[model samples]
Target: MENTRFNPVQLRRARIARGKTMTVLAKETGISRQMISNYELGKTIPSGNYLVKLISNLNFPKSYFSSGQASNLHGATFFRSQSAATKRARDMQSVRLSFQNDIYSVLSRYVNFPKVDIPEPLDMNVREMTDEIVKSMAMQIRERWGLGTSTPVDDVIRTAEVHGIIVVKTNMTNDKLDAVSEVIGGRPFIMLTDNGESSVRRRFNVAHELGHLVLHAGVESIHDFTTQQLKNTIERQANLFASTFLMPDEAFTESLLSTSLEYYVKMKKYWKTSIQSMVYKTYQLHLINDDQKLYLNKRISWNKWRRVEPLDDMLKVEEPTLFQKVFRMIVDNGIMSEADLLSELKLPFDELECSLGIKLNNKMAVSEPKLRLL
Candidate 1:
């Protein structure tokens, strides 16, 4: 059959993500290396028989061959193809979400945190707006949450995770979006990166994605954060959410009377915000002039402070990931089988094995070695 309709870019992306050179993949699948290059460059498509062999050996499903659907599911950025690896990655994500949701439901019973209200984002150009509105909204959110005193970043992360948020590792290879939040129905679901980013930056990414779930629901807009274009009002709202959540102006202003570097240094300890964030927030609150803002920005840039710092210095709470907890519960309770998950998630058997990093064939199937051999 003809392979002309498939996308070469997708093929290239899938191959690269799996870290397999054309020669390596060709050897594994018994396909010619030259043909692999051709497929990746869009010069030619694989025959039906060859394609099936590729998918089986690659451990991907038939759906991965389609560029449009697979690419869209991945937010159209990093992984371009629907290779076996991609399908497994997506399945792992879904399983993780399933786990997170269950844990969140249980945690909600004990936590009394106020639920964030979803509001329609005001229709204004995000780029044109000043930072004051963002600051004000953040203050409002903090007040609503009653986080009056300073809290550790670990506490904040735990609380968000309990509310169905999952943190992901971000790298140069992710979708061009700084963050993406997806929540089914009205629940707030978000994915963030620890990336050793400053406590303040991490908080901002979390709150920003949360803002999307609450504010941009039911909207059709581009979510890419790389392009230099006028952002939709919704994107602006999310950024505002992130800024305000990380640095509440009232609490910040109330505690400080001076703009000296010493004062900022002292406050940074409690707020756990980066010096740059403190400077930006200070400028946003009109606590400093444009000159100070420029100077501070230059200082930060010169220091190359954008690099993420290790969080080893901070306290780490035992917050199990959503999927892990849920999968454990299901397995422990005999609520489902490995087969059930594979079929529900549309993952090939081996892909499931790779994604979970567990020996499912043995562990998932072998009936609990007769605990009572009475």
Candidate 2:
């Protein structure tokens, strides 16, 4: 077969994802590092023999180098690997992946998968009741963790992982919803942060799903698995979970007696939540009476600004994403490599730019070894 022309930029990015330095790759492929550098920089075209060696060593398919198509797996878009434009999305992907692991670990203990128990339509009222379930589970979970009423936002997640659950984050195609919590064939799983949400929003999405895992586990066997119904149920459950998990009823009431909106807003940093979520929980827990709830909602615009939004709208970052986290864990643990990534994931290089969101250029070239005179 005639060799297809390879994109040098794409080849280099794949190598980095594999965590193999150019020196190590040079020794394995028996190619001079300078030649590899030249190929990567588009300074020279690689011969068929060179391409075969590269394809084999890098574990990329011959097609990846020969054709310019992006990896079809996960529908990732492959831009020119040399461009740094895709970095921001990839950075958020990394954080989302880290938190997803924490979510999966937490849910796995109670059940193998994350799913709701009921088969009925999860209307607003049923969804809203998730707060009650989370409050109850939050108390129990805290006791299991050997804590008092209130738990730090991060630690709450850590404790959940100790129980076993699978948390996954994906870039949902549209403005569908914030998150989804459910079970697949008796196991528990949750997907959070449909595309365009902030890290803080992602965090809340996980917590809301956790609420479903803990409180809605009883109803999983009956769920119909339709999109709208499932979303409504899970969102309500997660909202309840987020509320109770962030602020326990007893402590919230204690704080509510004296704290104002500004105090709660200030306290948001401690809870790792937004001012609006605190208000909803306070009202639900009855810490703030009806009058206070109405006043707070109007004051905070809970109807409009309920969940946490990002502070910085302009900053862009491309770090590892949830998929990359799994990749990193397996690679770091010696369980997988770049070959496995390509074969198993069928991922394309352009998508890698979006999925990993890292920048590469000719500046960080690998140098050839100098021959020493004996």
Candidate 3:
């Protein structure tokens, strides 16, 4: 094969996107670790068989490394449990984001994706973001989206995607990191763990991440919260935002009907929210007394509903379809062949399949000629 000059940055991205250390990549490619490091550092370029070995091991097309586009994350990510996630796991997630950026870049060439529609950050310091302010912001967002207080958001994932928020569902090794959100290249991207979580919980998670994008976008880092109180306040604010966004005051309060946990259970089918979430929302809205809230918590714990709640099977998971639609458009319109699209993506077919939650098959057939009628 002819030698191709590869970009060191793309090489490193492909390696890290696979969550492989330099040593592991070297072992797979039958190359020295130092040589791989040298290639990534731009000290030396891989050529001939060395380049072929790297491409085969990385599963990226030769053009991917030669392409000038760079994968860069612009802002911080708000992890669900920042302290519980290891630094290695976070770094791997960043690499995954970089790969996603690359995929988006390719898709942009063929389709006009919706511009991100998140509201402007509120004019308040992080220290001044109280629960009331957060609730107000959530209500304002609902209004801006034309979602009336009483209407239940049927598909939160689709809602976000329609507003240009890229939602990715992937299997993460760190179970503590339930979901994460970030602003990359001025666009918001959210990643949810594909761990068989209930639809209600996933919708809440998406709303929670949206809270971070809207509320905490100004904060440089969560680590800046030196005190535990500050950290708790930030998280509490996001939680409040999620609750308020999902169940607005006017509708949720009227639907309260009763303070019993069973009442919340029956309401869950309508609201598409978890019973536990409704209980907390009720308490936050002062519909239930402190003792009532405690009783509901005990009931939840005693019945083992904390992990597996009721009606979990009934609510369907909201899968994203924008990317799939764009991919199909490009292929069906003959803009690009499936093989070419896969090559441009620089991702393994299986990996892309898992990321998009769809299958890719080459079964295009031409129609047979019709016989003339006598």
Q: lDDT of each prediction vs. the true structure?
A: 0.51, 0.50, 0.78
Write candidate 1's Cα lDDT for 1-374 as tens digits.
12325766556555654546789999998899999998887788888777767766655445445524222232211111112124335433433333333334433443433354434333444455455655555555555555553443345655565554454332222322333355543355554322344455556566666555444433443433332331435455566666567655566778667776656666666766666667777886788899988876776566565453223246232322544445455656666665554334333334434333345665443332222212
Which residue segments of model 2 deviate by more than 4 Å? 1-134, 146-148, 155-163, 185-187, 218-237, 257-259, 302-326, 333-336, 347-374
lDDT, residue 354, model 2: 40
**Model with the higher TM-score, candidate 1 or 2:** 1
Question: Candidate 2 or 3, higher TM-score?
Answer: 3
Best by TM-score: 3
Worst 10 residues of 1 by lDDT: 75-84
Error of 1 at 189 (Å): 3.2
TM-score per candidate, in order?
0.58, 0.51, 0.87
Model 2 weakest 10-residue run by lDDT = 73-82
Which candidate number has the best lDDT? Answer: 3
Candidate 1 stretches greater than 4 Å from native: 1-52, 56-58, 61-154, 164-177, 185-187, 193-199, 223-226, 231-236, 308-320, 337-374
For model 3, the superposed segments whose C-alpha errors exceed 4 Å read 1-4, 26-30, 47-58, 171-173, 226-231, 362-374
Residue lDDT tens for model 2, 24-101: 888999988898889878898888777777767775555545544322112111111112223434333332333333
Predicted structure 3, TM vs. truth: 0.87
Ranking by TM-score: 3, 1, 2
RMSD of 1: 9.5
